[model samples]
Every structure is written in C-alpha cells, then in structure tokens.
Target: METITKIVTRFGGVSLLPVAVALLAFVLIGAPSSWVTLTIAGLAMGMMIFLMASGLSLVFGLMDVMNFGHSAFISFGAFIAASVLAGLSGWLGSDLIILNIAALFLAFAAAILFGMAAGWFFEAVIIKPVYKDHLRQILITMGALIVAEQMILALWGGAPMTVHRPQFLEGSFLIGDITIEVYRAFAFMLGLAVYVALYLTLNRTRIGLLIRAGVENREMVEALGFRIDRLFVGVFMLGSALAAMGGAIWAGYETLITPALGGEMMIVVFIVVIIGGLGSIEGTLLGAIMVGLMANYVGYLAPKLALTSNMILMMVILLWRPNGLKPAVK
Candidate 1:
C-alpha cells in the first residue's frame, strides 16, 4: 500500500499506464455487435448508479453513517408510485400523463417525509452517541436495516408490485436502425439534472460550504458560531431525500417494488460509497460509472460477471488504491 501510494505520488495519477490499459480493453474486445444499443444501455445503467450513490455518499460525508436503508427508500418510492398508478388505473383509463404526474408528486412527498423522519430518528438516537465509532455505527445500522426490511415486508406484504408504463413512455422511438425507450431517456435526463444540482449545492452555496467545513472539522465548526448538530441532521435529511428520489425514479423503470430491494440494493450502494471514497462527489461519479458500465457490459458477455462486476471492481480499486477513487479531503 505504501509503495503504491509512493508510486502514485511520484508519477501522478494521469500517467500513461491507465490510458494504455484502457485502450487495450477496447482493442482486445471491440465494441459489441449491437454497439449502439449496448452503449446506450451501459450509459443508462451508470447513470442509475450515480443517482443511488449520490445519496449514499452525502450521508457518509456528514453523518459518517452508512444507512443501508437507503435502498429501502428506493423500494418505498417505487411502491408508492406503483400503488398510485394501480389505484388510478382501476378507476381512470390509465392515462400516462396523469398517472406519471400523480405518481411523481405523491412519491416525492412521501419520500421527503419518510426520509426526513429516518434522518431525524437516526440523529436523535442511534448516531448521536456513536458518532465517532465506525464499528458501532456499522452494527447499529445493520440492525436498523433488518428492522426496516421487516417493516417493509409487513407494510407492502412482500409482493412484487409492477409499475405500468404510461402510454407516452410505454414504447420506443426509432432512430435510423436503432430504437430508444422514452422512459430511459427521461431517467437519464433526470439523473443528469440531479447530479448537476448536487454539484452546485456542494460547491456553490453557503449551506454547502458549511457542509464541507463540518465534514472536515465537526468539532471546529461547533467551536465557532454554527450549530454543528443541526447541520448533521440537515445533512442526514438531504442524503435520505436523495436516496428516496432515486427510489422513486427507479419505481418508474422497474415497475415493480419489492421489500428485498433495500437489502439487495444496499450492498451495491455500500460498494459505491467505499469504492468512490467516503465523501468525494467526483469519486462517487467516476466510481458509479465504472461500476455501472462494468455491470452492463459484463452482463452482455456473462450474467454471472454482470452480477459480480462491481464487487470485482471494488477489490481491484481497493487493491490499487485502497482509499478509493478519491479519498476524502481533510
């Protein structure tokens, strides 16, 4: 580890080795037969990862709490949207615009409230005492995840709820020889906007500046005028809200919400946070792209590889740069 760090420090991260290796990947295996489709799918997958990781990264950044329940929020969002659509479909003629608009707004409101509650409880109880202890946080959060999962099962009945694609987003568009789903395009656009908004919030606002400061030196900020404690709560709320938003968007894409999704998806999110570095937004983006692309591209070659690609990526990145893509700034 010391030797690798020394090498990176001396040679710098922009060395030719990475570029050469990247070129080699494309050379060894040229673009797939359906290169365009594959590329589009890969991009879409990566963007989804970015959305999920954004929330995870922010939570870890401020609270230092790895809320595995982030996935639960996603499940909740999907379920909420699915349920609303289901209700509307039964009475109304299943209009796409109305269903989508209704689902989106309901999901958004539900998610915000749910997320805020989660954040408040976490800070008021589990996290405040163990703020500085990694092991304790891990155990407590794991327990919380299990509890949340059970609650989901009890509430949603563990059924696989499917989301009906509205008429407007149900089909695809033909472009020359290829076709593209309208929903996928919408998802991409939404993800990009979320990313941009997060970046601006982190880099362009006073609250954001305080967040950066708090992350760097929580005690120091407390020593000053600001209420570092409330800041923690605010950060927690923000993170949870982001996760919930991702969940809601995911509901539209998958059209099915399952209780197990929280546990299942949380693992990937954990990897994203670790591989991308604890709190660096840039690292999270790059890491998500890497993980997302790996999953999509490898799935094309082998289903098994697709399932495990991100884990492998994590191992490789940790081996090469154990601190992750971008280590947290002090």
Candidate 2:
C-alpha cells in the first residue's frame, strides 16, 4: 500500500490533469467558439465549487472533522446575501458601477460574518464534544444539517427565491464568436483571488505554518506552547466564512435559490474535495476545474451523461489514485 501510495503521489506531483483534459476536449468538440465558451464557463463553475469545497477540505484535512452540516452554512449565506442584495436593490439597480460594487461587497460581508458566527457556535455547541470520533461527528453533523434546513424553511419559507445581479453583471461580452458572462468572470476572479490568498497564507505565513504543523502532529505543536485548540477554532470559523462567501457568489450566479440549495450542492462540493485530495487546496482547485470542465463539455455534448459525469470521474480517479490526486502528507 505504501509503495503504491508513493508512486501515485509522485505521478500526481505535477498538476496537468485539467489541462490535459481540456486539450482533449478541445479536439473532440472541434468547434473553437463552442469550446472556448464551454471552457470558460467550466472554469467559472469550477472556481465556485472550489470556494465552497476548500473550507470543507481544510476542516477535514486539518481538524479531521466530518462536518455533514457544512452545507447549512452555504444555504444560510445564500439566503442572507440574497436578502441583503434585495434590501439594497436601489444600489444594485443603480447604473453606477461603484454603487453596484458596494452593494455586492456588503452582501458578501453579511454572509461571511454570519457564517463565522454560526461556525463558532457550531464548533462550541455541537462539535466540541465529538472530537476524534468520526461516527459521532457524522451523525451529529447530519442531524445539524437537517435542523438547519428546517430552520431555513421556517425563516424563508418553502419557495425558490430569485436574485437579481447588478446591472453591470447581468449581460455578456463577445470575444469573436464566443460569449462570456460578466458575473462568471467575476466569480472566476474572486475564486482565483481566494485561492492565491489561501495559498500564501498556508505556505508563507507563521499561522499557516502552525496550522500545517498541527495537522501533521497536534501533540507536538501543543507541546511547543501554542494552543492548537484556539487555532483549530479559528480554522473552523474561516472555513465557514469561505463556504458562506462561496454561497453568496453562487447565489448570484444561479439567480435563484431555495432552502435545499446547500443540500443539493453538498454532493458536488464533497466530490471536489475528495478528488482534489482531502486537505489540499491546490488539489481542490484542480479537481474543481476538472469537474467543471467535464460537466460543461459532457452536458453540451451529451446531456444525459452530465448528471453522472462527476460520479464516473470520481470512480475513475479513485481507481487510479486511492488517496486522491494530491492527498495531504499527514
């Protein structure tokens, strides 16, 4: 097993799978315009998925917590962001770009703050007692997810809510025969920014070093006088915040959200996290891009295969590399 693991890890060291798949897709699709459009759309979609999945990966990889209720935060973020955007319709509706940007920022802020608070509360009230026990963590978190869905229904009712994008973000621009939506571009940039920020924080900062060390050996880190518990709590809060931010961005992309939004997206998020490697942000990005591209390409080429594409992808990848494309060393 160890030998196979080493070989797989070595083989997966360089991240070119997504690029390889994209090239193959371009050839198979055979339409430059259509391929370009689909590829951009896929990248945008994958970035959003990465945003949502990154948090879960971190928590799972670092804290070893099975948080089935993570989706609740996503739903909450979408609803809250939607409400904020609705209330700020005047600003969002304004033709002024600055106002539109402000409104969007405010909405995202509200969602992230709410997510942080909820995450802290969840960690303290529900997760603290179940440390190191996967079964209890799963059971309790799943129950939490159920209750959260109910709460969402109670608060927002059982109907789909529509979200309107800012005036500047509602349309598309054409580059030759290809069209790119403004909102999608924004999502891609945002996701990329988050990824860069996270990468730097994890790889270049002292806090990130502590977090990594803790992940590898919690006892060793704590023995060095750093309170690993507080660090972990902070991680949970950050993870929840990221999930909410992703939800907010995604809500704008979809233009419609329901109480079960998070529940529905959970599958994709988990798949991305799993395929990307449990705790690897880079892997998550690659996995997300691959899934996104696969979905768009398959959906365009064969609609029937779209729904099952991710599942098939996961199965194939797992068969090739059991620990995922880039599993955390710890």
**Model 2: lDDT of residue 319:** 79
Global lDDT of each model? 0.70, 0.92
Report the C-alpha lDDT of model 2 over 82-168, residue by residue, as the tens digit: 999999999999989999999999999999999999999999999999999999999999999999999999999999999878888
Residue range 1-330, candidate 1, lDDT tens digits: 777667766765623333333344455447633445555655565576677777778778766775655676666655665666666563324554676566556655776677668767866787788777888888887777788778878877867877765566667787877667777777778778878987899899998888877767777887889997788788777777667667766777777768777677777777878888887777777676666656656776567777777788889789988778775663
**Total backbone clashes of candidate 2, pairs 3 or more residues apart or in separate chains:** 0
Identify the runs in model 2 with alpha carbons over 4 angstroms from their true place.
Answer: 1-14
Top candidate by lDDT = 2
Tell me how far the alpha carbon of residue 300 in candidate 1 is from the true structure, in angstroms, after superposition: 0.6
Model 2, TM vs. native: 0.96
TM-score of 1: 0.86
- lDDT of model number 1: 0.70
